[model samples]
Target: MAISNVLMFGMVDFSGLLDKFGIDWHLLLIQSLNFVLVAFLLYRFGFRSVARVMDERREKIELGLKYADDMKREKAAFESSRAQRAESARREAEGIVKSAKDGAKAILEQGKMELQQQSAGMILNAEKEIARRRKKILGDAKAEIGTLVVEVAKSVLASQMTDRDRNNYAAMAEKMLP
Candidate 1:
């Protein structure tokens, strides 16, 4: 097998092709060397610049991620503060409503007291007016009774004088003597 591989390598006939084409092996070797040198130079200069730009882009992406995190925290804080203010406003509104309710209750009580006082005053005035009217009626009735007694006494005296004659008056006068 080694013999056959060596024979195959030797019978390749690359020199005949190069001779027919008037190509120099040494010039080919030099051109190959030049290509390797140009590739190395491009790798050192061009590839390094591209790698630097890529590194800068990666750093900018990291910074943007950090900025986004900070914005999220700020938004959370703003929402918390807004919630606190809303609670405070709700408490204040409740207090105001309670105070208004209390005030209304107080006003209602005061009005009731005033109404009671007015009612009592009116009752007292009515009682006083009724008593005055009763007293006036009694006084008028007593005056009428006194006038009737005086007229009855006068009629009795006139009847007794008309029934008696002058002789009966003298006899009654004698009988009345002590």
Candidate 2:
């Protein structure tokens, strides 16, 4: 009740000031009504459309931001997948190279063994040929030495021999020739 009395007292003083200023209540009420009508028309016709457009723009901006974030995540996932594939390819390439090296080594070893076998076979064949040739040469030399000894004995015995002595010496030489 006291607060109401105080508010009424302030209103009385304010009304007296307004009267002194020649502020007519009827003119004030008409102006207030005009202002309210203008404000309502402006809010309904202009501000509502502007607010709707702003809301649409805000939604579009949010969608664009969400799309950008999704794209970033997708790019990160793609990069991770690509890196893993690259690592796998590297390992596969290394494995292929290692296998190739091992295969090459095996081939080289096989070739070396084959070459050694061929060389050993060739050496054995050459040794056999040499031994055969040596044996043939020794036989030929022995035959030639025997023929020379018989011819030398014949010449020496022929120079001093009668037919009877020749026959006896030839029989003895034939017995001793070998």
Q: Clash totals for all models, in order?
A: 0, 0
Worst 10 residues of 1 by lDDT: 162-171
Model 1: how far residue 118 lies from native, Å: 1.7
Listing every candidate in turn, what is its Cα RMSD in Å to the true structure after a full C-alpha superposition?
Answer: 12.8, 6.9
Clashing pairs in 2: none
Over 4 Å off, model 1: 1-63, 136-178
Model 2: how far is 121 from its true place, Å? 1.8
Structural similarity to truth (TM-score) of each candidate: 0.48, 0.61
Q: Cα miss at 72, model 1 (Å)?
A: 2.1
Candidate 2 TM-score to native: 0.61
Q: RMSD in angstroms, candidate 1?
A: 12.8
